[model samples]
Target chain A: MKAPVAVNGYGTIGKRVAEAIRQMPDLELKGIVKYTPDYSVLVAYRQGIPIYVPKGKEGVFEEVGVKPSGTVDELFGSVSLVVDASPGGKGAQNKRVYVERGLSALFEGGESPDVAEVSFSTLCNYRQALGKKYIRVVSCNTTALLRLICLLDRHIGVRKARAVIVRRASDPKEDKGIVNTVKLDPPSIPSHHAIDVKTVLPDLDIETVALIVPTTLMHVHVVHIQTKRSTSIDEVVETLSSTPRIVVLEGAKIGIDSTSKIVEFARDLGRKRYDIYENVVWRDMIKVNGDELTIVQAVHQEAIVIPENIDAIRAALRLAESAEETMRVTDKVLNVGLQR
Target chain B: MKAPVAVNGYGTIGKRVAEAIRQMPDLELKGIVKYTPDYSVLVAYRQGIPIYVPKGKEGVFEEVGVKPSGTVDELFGSVSLVVDASPGGKGAQNKRVYVERGLSALFEGGESPDVAEVSFSTLCNYRQALGKKYIRVVSCNTTALLRLICLLDRHIGVRKARAVIVRRASDPKEDKGIVNTVKLDPPSIPSHHAIDVKTVLPDLDIETVALIVPTTLMHVHVVHIQTKRSTSIDEVVETLSSTPRIVVLEGAKIGIDSTSKIVEFARDLGRKRYDIYENVVWRDMIKVNGDELTIVQAVHQEAIVIPENIDAIRAALRLAESAEETMRVTDKVLNVGLQR
Candidate 1:
């Protein structure tokens, strides 16, 4: 029997999670929850996925001419797992509802680790989340970082890591009043990212500073990692290329020169909303100087976490015996890494 | 009296060099040399800058309905310095003409070090090029690399360096039939960029790989430098921030996020062809992990060499006694780091 899962909050992350859950063979998307009768609510309805509204906001859905199938409270009893894709702080508020119903839950990166039994990254702590009542699937940025770090750590042992996140201001669908000027994160030294990554790999030394730029395309990351052993650029490339979900982009092989072109390639391939589920690393940009490895990669902020969400479902419920088995199934079913 | 300077070739590099020379108070735009009466030749004519053609191509200009002021031979006798902005190998051919005329000439990075008396970068070797007969202003990529390297070497010694060049396939005007796939420079290992940078900083150990991406906007570089001494990300940022021609972009302050938005910002600023002449370093992307310093910066391929061309003119003609004075004048006239 497929494990039933409900996606709460139909924003960028919520909508993607719902679609991914529906695609997985081991999971059933019970319904999607939305606070307002936005266009996504209509999309969820048209996709034949049931939609639920917050307890107090049910009346507003009819005013917007769309009928939600039920209230969010009704979703708790029907699903074994509740994936909270709500806005940053809202996950904490919604966690109470899930806990009271004794349902396993997954929260997005926006929430604190305290909100869940454990913070999760499929590559770093997939096994840890198994049989856990609550798991927080790390944010898109953390997921992208973890993929590289886990690969490097496994192959050559990462001694230290640093990253600069050129973040997108907002998702294409929503407007949060993106600023025009590039400003440093306030109290800038060791931005919250460093702390977040630690939750997965507690001993790893990583420092990150994030800047929100005015483009809705994707977040570009410039990463520098120092390896424990000597390695060459070619060796580093070979290692990363072999890793799953890490798409190595060569300008000649893929005919894509920039992140914008990568988006175009995805759209041309008829990907869902041009979503690139993999971490697009510039194949040419992977270099090793002495023991340091450097790479420039683009992370599609909205889509990267989608696959992780799917894996987190199986992980939270102990459905998959191993991460490799879960990742292989997810990639095969979702067509993840086939773009290249 | 202004020193007369002639720019040979009417491609991306040549046009910018001609315009920059025209704007400088210390130099006079003698004439621009074009092998073909392309649209850019017409542009030079419309801008009231005198246009010259290769001896045999003079008639081609009139056939294309654009009048040439004289042959390239006439430019040799009229100018004190000739900046060879021609195609890669063409500069070697033009070098013989400059020698025959006893005219001091500056070659673009396309030419080998053997073609010139010294390889010049305003930040690295302006003094070395002073009063020299022939000098090659390093390529846009080399110039950008030198800017970071020189600063790092000065603040904290650099033990070694590695770089991945995410290069643009073509300039905005030309269509070089850019391929979609990311390709390593054929015979891939260490691209010529590794050697090219050594021309400016011979003692610095560095290795690089270049891939041509299908974007005319700019080239993004992922650089990792192992500092001789340990450093912090804040110290690295402060050092780079103080360097001239290095624009540190913070996502919050400038609202400029991606390379495309940067192009848009340049266009909104009413820049020449929306060109970003400086090396735009993402402030948040600079990180020092252990002993390794990492940065991601964008180089406007066509425009980066423009300022170096101006400085080369000064260096070749002995117009400025110090690089600081020449750079100050060039920045004042061209508005180098004011994009933000």
Candidate 2:
């Protein structure tokens, strides 16, 4: 029998995670919790997915002309795990209810490290989340960083890494952000994203600084890593190209020069929702000088972490004995790295 | 007697270098070469500075109502050394004339490293240029990176250094640049900057990437350096604060945040031409975690290297026996670090 999973929130990540769960053969989408009876809740209801509401909000759903499937408690009691994809800082408050009912839960990056048993990035620490009661999949930026850093560590051995994160001001659907200025995200050095990466890869020495630009499509990381031993550029290129969820685009050959062009490339690829689930690395930006490597890659902020959220559920439930097994199953279902 | 010096191009860097030479007690500005009979030629001519023209372009000077002081060959014969501030790539072609006349020349960062005997950064290797026939001062961005890296290396002993150069799309007076895009300057990795830094400091390991934002004021560098041993934040801050041609500004206390604000601060200080000759470092961006030091500094593209050009002349002429003496003399005459 497939293990039933309930997504506690049907917002940005929760909706994507629910759709991913329904496609997996080993998992089934039990229900989704919605606090507001807005257009999104109506859309999910019209799609034939079960919608659970709070105990006192049944009248609100009825007023929207959509009958609720059940209460949030009923959804929690029926599923094997709950993926809490609520807004940042809200998951920490909702954790008390999940623990009171003896339920295993996975939180998003917004929660503190204390709220979960393990801070999870599938490529970096998948086994650590196996059988854990609470696991937190890191933020979108951290997931993008780990996928490259961990892959390099496994092949060429990374001794030190530094990143300059050129961040997108906001998601595509958001209306608020800087209009014409390049603002420092925190107005400080070594922003919080660096520390979050260390929560999973404790032995890695890395430092990062972030700047929020006016663009909203994706975030670009200018990364420099020192290898443990001397490695050639061809070796690094081969390893990343042969990997599962990375798409290498040669700027000189294909004319993919900017982050905006990468988004248009995704749209041309006919991806569902124009979403790119892979890290888009420019082949022209990869340089290997002796033991040091420098490269530039762009991460689709809205969709890069969706696949990791799926793998987190399998790792937390012990559905697969190893990380590679879970990744193979998840990558195949998501059609990750196949469109390229 | 003041040593005679001639400026080989009266453009952006040449005019500033000529003015700096005029203010020096031990150096005299003999004349400046003007290729175009533009409005700037009239300004320099009215200032009582001699204007020299190429062999055949004497008519161009006559068309602009400015009488030629002499020919380019005459300027080369009169000066003890010629500061070759010609346009980039033009300096390489003009080097043969200086070599033929047996005149020592100082080239700007635009020329190749082979164009000079040493790639120069005043703070890193002032002595390396002493008594040299040809010296090339590194580019503006490379000069900015060398200042902080060499400073930190002195007090904390830097083991590895990495930089992300956020470049201005163009100088303030130029009309050619990106309109509303953040472009990778070369659309490649490890931009020529890292190798340029190594040309001055041969033993230091460093990597750099550059991005061109749609701003014309100044270029900012996000730098990370790993010290040879563990150090505290106080030591790194104190080291940078006590150095010449470097300014430390607090973001919270003074509300000095972005690079644009730094220019405003310099304007408010009533600086001539609103030029900030020092590297404006944000205090809030200085962080030391264990052995790593991270900093964000803004280098005014037009003015930061003017002070270096003065020190380069002193070093190349053997006017000062040590780097510290040259810096002290140059910094005092330019009122560097005085506004703060």
Report the C-alpha lDDT of model 1 over B1-340, residue by residue, as the tens digit: 9998898887888888888888899899999887766787787898999988777786778987788889878877899889888889889987888898899998999888889988988887789889999998888899899988988888888998877676666776775735433333532446888898998898888877665554667777767788998999788888887756888888446666557778888899899789788888877667677787777787888898888889988988888988898988998888998823
| Whole-model alpha-carbon lDDT for candidate 2 | 0.85
TM-score of each: 0.77, 0.82
Q: What DockQ would you assign to candidate 1?
A: 0.09
lDDT of 1 by residue, A163-206 (tens): 76666666777657344333344324466877888999999988
- What's the chain B TM-score of candidate 2? 0.97
**Tens-digit lDDT track for model 2 on A1-340?**
9999999888778888888898999998999999989888888888888999989899999998889999988899999899999998888999998888878889999888889999998888988899998999998889889999998899989998888888887787778866434566678866888899999998788878888766677888898888999998789888787667787788768877777777777789787777878888888889898888887988888888888888989888889977889889888888898732
TM-score of chain B of each: 0.95, 0.97
How high is the CA lDDT of each candidate model?
0.81, 0.85
- Best candidate according to DockQ: 2
Query: Worst ten-residue run, lDDT, model 2 chain B?
Result: B177-186
DockQ (Cα-based) per candidate?
0.09, 0.32
For candidate 2, give the lDDT of residue A78: 93
* Model 2 agreement with the true structure over B182-280: per-residue lDDT tens digits: 567678767899889989988888877888776777887888888999998778778888777788877758777667677788899898778888888
